[model samples]
Target: MSNLPKTMKALVAYGPGDYRLETEHPVPVCGPDDIIIKTEGCGVCVSDVKCYHGAGRYWGSETEKAWVEPPFIPGHEFLGFVAEIGENVKGFEIGDRITADQILPCGECRFCKSGRYWMCQPHKMFGYQNTNDGGMAEYVRYPKTAVISRVPKELPREKALLIEPYACSKHAVDRAGVTNEDILVIAGAGTLGLGMITYARMKNPAKLVVVDMIDERLEKAKDFGADIVINPSKEDAIAKIMELTDGYGCDIYIEATGHPSSVKQGLAMVRKLGTFVEFGVFAQETSVDWSVIGDGKELNVLGSHISPYCYPFVIEHMTDGSLKTDGLIKRTFPIEKWEEAFEYASGKYGDFKVAITFD
Candidate 1:
């Protein structure tokens, strides 16, 4: 082994409104069952903006109370190749292509033992804190527990980077319990919303209607297999769905936009005995009016957190090209141009799913 540097260059946040290109960070070390991976690609997600910009802090940790010093790496959703493996690491070797779950769970926790590692006690996340430095840096170390699955040789790095959000959508679909005959409505045509569209299409629903504030996103939704697209800004989304469904609303209404108003709209748009899935991540407190569901609507509202038990399913879909993602990835950037990537992904430059590619 070469003598590795104790510090490396990484894009670090000094504080709120304070991000800079910096170096001299200690490289994460591998444990007995850990694996060190050299990042191949990283995606710029909206959650990253919430943490770096002013919307909210990552992991709900106060800015001043964060563990690592200012200027830490950022980017949890990524794909990489194994650079090194720990002594006890098996079933994987150096040069193996893989994507991580980004969630580090305590295997001893009851939730983890029960195959609910996503809800692991003392849960730590990559790129959110020191748990792992994440892919924004040159390399990251992860205990075997974090490795989700090996990336298929046919799956491009760009598509593999989508596994994280895809797992999220898969979890929502699993919880929503959409079947071949169910009518479904997805609110918000953004990345997460689009992922829902892609995954739900696998179920071959009777009708898949997508509602978005932006026409462009609605168009993207159509490309992702939404049977009908409605721009809520120009039309009454709920009324449109009702008319399309011949007065009865969709059997499943999913709220992918964090805006509470959209959630409320979904509630009003779903039919009685329908399922409402909440997949959006709200940065601030939100409120909803329940009167719409007061008259025995027989509604099933499910709150979905980060993914669990769906990594393999996501990987399979991505590998087979059944879920087309290239249309969803709007831009790619070199790791050095992360700031530009962030700007493009923030909707400032009219881009979606911007990814950072490492040489």
Candidate 2:
């Protein structure tokens, strides 16, 4: 505490498409129920890309409410060491390695009371809302109510940063309710999609197909235990899936591609009464035929939001090498080169995950 600096570098998002690096941002003060963390690294997520592109979900459309209040930092997936702890903060000490759930639940909400804190009505996401600054800085304050966990000291930096996404992916796979007889298809081979592959593989389904536009990502999917990888750009994905399924269609279709077309494609490729799990966050509204979900196929549509109570499981799997993290983190940059980091994360170089590092 004696050597702590008064100010530190942070990246602040001023508006929909405006993000700036601030070198003199104030180091957050620990409240009675909060703790200050010295950020080690923060991963750039697809949600961050959507927020950067001024997606309606973050900026709001005519029918939606904007959730992001700018002038706030924009990182949620991160790991750090506790630099300072409040008097009332417990189970954590200075220099403890920690990471927090991005969604800060209001314990009083109906969802929270029902044990579904991930869907709490008044939740404040660490990076998007004004209540808490994100980890795209030297320090981030973890509110008392936030679900915090101590990361294993032996975990590699890249694997540690994957905890959040892996948790979310676990939620998605669990929601899919996969079985040995089921033929599953996961659309997209990005971060979340790759994580989905890791968890879905554990189910030992009859067939596990991965769809991606990039050949490199598809190849990585193979390394992650994907039975089949489809390059949508080079092949008619729906036709191929139909042929493989003998026109019966796949039993489970998980959409992890943020592209709107993937939704329609999933609808077209899923068998009747099959489960369709939508896990991606789209940048805009996507309209599809309603009958396909009701009268036509009677598909079971499930929505996976964020990691709820699956963090511990994800951490265990990551620690045990069940979830491979070797090729996941493609690049890392100092917090000062946030613009460059964002650019690389934006898919200009077909990178998987990009992280901003401190020191």
lDDT digits (tens) for residues 109-226 of candidate 1: 9988998888888777777665556778777788767845888867877788889888888788889898888889888878777888999998999988898888888888888899
Candidate no. 2 TM-score: 0.96
Error of 1 at 74 (Å): 1.6
lDDT of 1 at 244: 78
Tens digits of lDDT, candidate 2, 166-236: 88998999999999999999998888889999888999999999999899999999999899999978999
Clashing pairs in 1: 12-71, 12-72
- Every candidate's lDDT: 0.79, 0.89
Worst 10 residues of 1 by lDDT: 59-68
Runs in model 2 lying further than 4 Å from the true structure:
1-3
Q: Over 4 Å off in model 1, which ranges?
A: 1-7, 57-71
